[model samples]
Target: MMDMLLRPRIILDAAEAEDAEALAEIHATGFRRGWSADEIDALIADKTVSSHVLRRESLFGVRRPQGFILIRTVADQAEVLTIVVAPAARGRGYGRRLMEAALRALYRDLVPEIFLEVDEKNASAVSLYRSLGFVEVGRRKGYYAEDHGPGGTALVLRLKLR
Candidate 1:
């Protein structure tokens, strides 16, 4: 049984190449088609990409990642490549915290606008984006493959940071 009284301390930090495996593991917990560690490592190695990880520290001082977010920037614009929180860590405000941190970082770097694509059928994610002030600017048909059916549409959202 899980101990409800001993909550782990959540911490956010910049992601490094060595965190690729942990990021992949968290991604796999949330998505059916998760990116591999090699893919995450290659993306993190890119000069234009910035990533962050959310970690949890247990009472014994053992730390492990619980979520991650990846962003790519070009000139004054930035795009969220991906963000995922482990299944067990969902509903704990980790996603919102990650987005807040990423947006602040982008804003500090002089990025005036940011964008992201989310599956249209993902209500929770869509709601979260809306709460974060992102508006749906476009949609891509059949952009994401569904787990049990045909492909799904992807909603492209944009947020003005400036």
Candidate 2:
């Protein structure tokens, strides 16, 4: 086992168009209906979207993408399109780091609020959003179809930024 503190430094930075394939790979691990590389490319290409990646940089300066967050801003509001951490990178505070960075960017842009819809059954995700000051505002029944079970509801959450 390696010392957690001594682990390679984690870098959070803006994602570029070239990262679509890698982001899609990470997205597939976290979602039931994952977006393809082309879909991710289109989203990243859109002028309204802001994308960020969390990467682990080795002492030798090799960086590997570990997680990402995508948000779309319209007018004075923003919505989180997706957020996911690679399965191997879970439980390492990467998700929170991504969210905090995204929120800061949105806030700095003077966005009034941000919203996201999360599957109600995703306890870890719900907890993370709540810890970041997101409050449940609405829900969509049967918003997410499961692989082998009944569909789950999507809880709409909002956080005031301004």
Candidate 3:
């Protein structure tokens, strides 16, 4: 079926330095302001950051990146820096999968809690985080820049990993 073919086999792997450009491209599609390839590369190279990429391997052995998630761990806690899925690949559960991968890795590492900030206007993203058991613990006023006027508030969400 078309659905089966499109699904393929997903392989989640630790993101490498070479993936910066691809990840940046995906990030650009998902955000108002995107991180540069250099920035993503630097994050991947940092000792405290954990980055994961999801690749879709087709029936004919074609492998391409669908999404990526970046998490920074400090001591007993971790924070989701960013997550983005390719524009064409959106709404196919890739975001959830990427978040799940990050959660599993953090849990395995014995991280007690994880936190992330999301624009309050991003309904889908907020919904996804809530579904994954994240609850809003705080808010930052006008934390996100807007094109025309005042920026939106950022909702700080947290999840207990332990």
What lDDT does each candidate get? Answer: 0.91, 0.94, 0.93
Cα deviation of 137, candidate 1, in Å: 0.5
For residue 91, model 2's alpha carbon misses the true position, in angstroms, by: 0.5
Q: What TM value does model 1 have?
A: 0.92
* Least accurate 10 contiguous residues by lDDT in model 2: 1-10
Q: Go through the candidates in order and give the clash count of each.
A: 0, 0, 0
> Which ranges in model 2 have alpha carbons more than 4 Å from their true place?
1-6, 148-150
TM-score of each: 0.92, 0.93, 0.93
User: Which digits, one per residue and each the tens of the lDDT, describe model 1 over residues 68-108?
Assistant: 89999998899999999998889989999999999999988
Candidate 2 lDDT over 1-162, as tens digits, reads 568756898889988878889999999999988999999999998999999999998878888899999999999899999999999999989999999999999988999999999999899999999999999999998889977666899999999998
Model 1 scores worst on lDDT over the 10 consecutive residues at 1-10
lDDT score for candidate 1 against the true structure: 0.91
Distance from true position, residue 156, model 3, in Å? 0.3
